[model samples]
Target: MTPAEVRARATGPTAGLAEGYAQANLIAVPADWAYDVLLFTQRNPQPCPVLDVTDAGSPRTVLAPGADLRTDLPRYRVWRDGELVEEPTDVKGHWRDDLVAFLIGCSFTFEAGLRRAGVPLRHVDQGRNVSMYVTDRQCRPAGRMRGPVVVSMRWVPTALVGTAREVTARMPAVHGAPVHVGDPSALGIADVGRPDFGDPVTPEPGDVPVFWACGVTPQAALMASGPPFAITHAPGHMFVTDVPDSAYRI
Candidate 1:
């Protein structure tokens, strides 16, 4: 499906949808805090690779021309004083003139490469959102933006772990490689079955859990820094773009 078609549906997680296109995580903050956000992403590029940044007060992005950021995404999270205020399908009522939006490269954009490499994607196959957990590791802070790094988990077969890494490593823009390939405990995750965000995915007997730095790291920062006001794509519900996944491949 195209972005416009995805926009029409306007609800639910985006995994496995618009299969070959690049998807992005959306985070729009007031103009005053734009510099901090930009600096934060630059300091922590692995979890926050930038795809596009919009002009203040504009909902249009070059990633998918003519698509409105305010409504194109399936769901949005509105935050105030570092707390989640709402999860709305449309953010038109909350769109602000001084808001500057950042489109962060999403791991979902790299799934096609993994698929082509024959690395199984359990979450996609199970019709569930990928599991995401907030880790104990802190991100390199820039200005007032600071938080623990968050990661998305996928259970790759023990033998295909290397294949999964190589396929993803070429696409650095969308979190190029796995941060952890074996134990979730190494990241301070006490329970592999429970996630801070998204759904839990069970691994098959021969599978090894693989974790990648996630775009949701911004949301972690949002919650930690108390940004006053912000807008983000609801976890798992990303903004599908017109760019092909190959565009991000090396």
Candidate 2:
């Protein structure tokens, strides 16, 4: 589907949509907090890989010129004092002159490569969102931004784990490589069927769970830091960029 079509279906999550285009996680905060957020991303590149940052108060981004950040994404989450206040399909009403938007790399960009390499994504196959869990591990803090690491889990066949890693490792811009493979408990995940965000997909008997750092880490940090106001793409919902998937492949 085209990015516009994905936006038209704004109520649904963007996972598995716009196959060849790059998808990003959105984080918009007051300009005062931009530097800290940038530093946080720089420090935690795996989960918070920086893709683009808009000029303060402006929605235009080089990644997708002419796209409207306020209305282009599938869905948005509004936060007030770290509490979720709204989940809206459009954020035009919440757009502020002091808001700065940051686009972070999303693993969705690499799924195509995985599919090409014969690594099946059960979530996509089942029409469910990938499972995400908040781990006990804390990210490297930057200024006031600090929170537990969030991970997206996919069940990979034990034999294809290496293929999955090699395919994703080439796309460093979209969070290259797996952070953890096998044993979800090692990452403090108690139940494979339950997730803190997104839908859970059951693993086949021969599949082993693989974890990757997720863009939701920054949103978790923003919430923990108690930022007065913030906006982010709802988990699984993403901002589709005009850039091609190959542009980020290394």
Clash pairs, candidate 2, are: none
Candidate 1 local lDDT, 7-117, one digit each (tens): 778488998898899999999999999999999999999999999999999999999996999999989999999999999999999999999999999999989888988
Listed in order, each prediction's TM-score against the native is: 0.99, 0.98
lDDT by residue (1-250, candidate 2, tens digit) is 7876776665677777889889999999999889989999999999999999999999888988868999988789999999999999899999999999999999999998899899998999998988999998999999889999999999999999999999999988898999999888999999989999999898888999999999999989988998899999999999988899999998
Query: lDDT: which candidate is best?
Result: 1
lDDT of 1 at 225: 94
Query: Which residue pairs in candidate 1 have backbone atoms (N, alpha carbon, C) closer than 3 angstroms, thus clashing?
Result: none
